[model samples]
Target chain A: MSGPDDMQGDMPEMTPDEILALDLALGALPREERRAAQLRLRSDPAFRALVEGFEADLSPLDATTDPVLPPRSVWEGILAETAPQPVRTAAPVSAPKPSLWNSLALWRGLGFAGTAAAAIALVTAAPQRQPLAPAEVATATPEAPPQMLAASLAGADGTPLLSATWDPLRGTVVITPAAKPEAEAAGTTPELWVIEGDKPPRSLGTIDISGPNAHAISSQRIAGLQPGSTLAISIEPMGGSPTGLPTGPVVATGKLSAI
Target chain B: MHGPVVRAPASPGAAELVQLLGRAADGDAAAFRDFYDRTSAKLFGIILRILPDRGEAEDVLQEVYVTIWRKAAEFDSTRASPVTWAATIARNRSIDRLRARASRPAAPLETAHDVADAAPMADALIDTMRGAASVHAALAALEPRQAAAIRSCYFEGLTYEALAEREGVPVGTLKSWVRRGILRMRAAMAEAGATA
Candidate 1:
């Protein structure tokens, strides 16, 4: 398959180690060779350095290709997969818990049926907190058993900032904000916390103030969702409070109630 | 050897990405989302080039981000820039998918032409990065066949055996071309870094 006069002269010779590193970096090694090279990478610092060097050197090529915005569904899929799953708990003596897929179907089937009742409960429970708009309540399909626990959080000035709903069966909390929270100070972020009587606050993770977000709760933490427990938002350093307790002033607070 | 340059919009600086990754490691989904918004397009570009099929490429993209989330703690800023680290993951995952398939699909026409033409697309598009120009410059300096072999191997994730068959050459010859090209490029990059 060679040309009559292929130009093979003046080519520099590469050591086998260098070849191995190049192949590994390029993802070109056969399966067996790849496994062997990977093992070598862990044990051989010099070989590892070679691979890293090649990877760094070759990385600039990434900038050459035109960036294409992947469809939004890709991000949605990522969120679904990466969202925390309900921690497995032992089956109760009486009845087995439904599988996640089954619960999700049941949840969808009950959609909007209980929203009006839930909104009324939210209004009567906290007069200071702004109620969900009438338009939102008007869209309810019909009365289905209420299956969600909800809270309407407000700032100290009595202005509604956000609302939260906990779906116990799905083990997810959906947070919908009325408006974007004020910009955080440099090096800090707005964190969500669940605080029950006497115990220290548990972080629900940093909240996205710009839009609605859903977070899965583990069964152990789900105990914090009792009717009188409080959900608060506080400003914490980038990742969150290192001490596992709120270190800044509370920006908003609301009480959880079953609707 | 340069092709038409397609400039990417300005992205978050490296330091910001590092910070975002740190927060992500701490389980900050918001920080993770911000990171994804800033970086996904570029990583998707890298994946789509290797995989070609939109569905396959998008699936691989999802897998890559999930990996980034799980492995954010392992990122070492001292070793590589955040973009490079993420890009490496994307490339490796896409290549893994490529290799795992029962039979390699025919190379897409644009990719085949790019390799055959030996056009240094990287040099044209990556001029902003400090040493990028030199890497592509060195690539352009290589013999055309050697350069083609390197590009095919890197961008298409073609193994020596696969590439050799495609080019109607011995696998050893294909490997030789890539190895020689890599050494020259590395040396050129080092020289450029030293001078800079």
Candidate 2:
């Protein structure tokens, strides 16, 4: 619908080759033109050479760019999203369409059931202590934001597999796995790791992949909760990684950004 | 655009980068991690400049690597260096995101000062390839408006129409400027290489 707004006033007539080269460089060509160029890239040596030359000329713009470090969670998210170890879920006759694992509603819709109830009970039964907000009574803090900084651990397909939240006030890390990962065959337990800056992940504790599990994080360990730290879930052997590192594929992971 | 020199981990040279990419193509997680570590920051910067939102840039950066993971094997070093190939992908994806948002009234352009400005890599890195210096020299030789058109088009991934709109110039003038700018830079860079 929107043509390059029909170039106005006294345009010099250009050769088709020059226009094609410029169009490729700017990616301004319509879809059909782009497809034709791509076909030319494969089939027409002269055209390919022309395109590559333009790419070379323009590439310095890329080379001189300032480098900005992305948040640690980005790489972790990439790993969790792309790490394609075979998922042990029962292979269905037809594969289910890929779902958005990042949706909190999807997890909530799955009926966290008793695990959800237990999470509330644990939050309540545990000392109603507010380490930082001493002025306000802990009893009044809402269920979500104030008490917990959560990471939704998803499978390779972005299916929400586990939810790990760091409850700073309670000094505990709560992990609620949505459903049993069939990967739990033969005594393998899901281990949690705190992935921090360029450091080898440190084990938070082992968690049951089939149910809700909580680990009391010592004050010394809570220091890792600095923004950008991640809670990574990996399927490890019965006793967890023998070397105190993540020995298995990181199945699910989420970042621990401060609220 | 000049700023304080910030030294970074020198780019992994072309050969090693290609090797890492090939390994990643074969589904080697460790190799992919190494590839990501070396390039993500640079790629993030490019995307951030175009998008100007940290969260959106991060999301797009993640998408770039996932695309890289799937398509690493398709990288033909004979045609382009690893950085060029990957940066092209990043640029294209960022543009796609920009175009998708064009229909709606987008947020005001965040000025360069407003974006979290990281110190630029020092000249040593910039000059590692003689081609880069020549390219910069070439850009410097252009008329100021022509050079700005080229940079804004390449860096922001703006189409001729969008750039024309932003500059309040006729699309024909903007296109001519950009086309002439590219041709001029090509000659200047080739000459610089000849001297080298």
Q: For each candidate, give its TM-score against the true structure.
A: 0.55, 0.54
Candidate 2 lDDT over B124-149, as tens digits, reads 23423455677788889888888888
Collision pairs in model 2 = none
Runs with alpha carbons beyond 4 Å of true place in candidate 1: A1-14, A85-259, B1-12, B109-128
CA lDDT for candidate 2: 0.61
In order, candidate lDDTs are: 0.65, 0.61
Clash pairs (backbone) in predicted model 1:
none
DockQ of each: 0.19, 0.14
Instruction: Give Cα distance to truth, residue A252, candidate 1, Å.
Output: 43
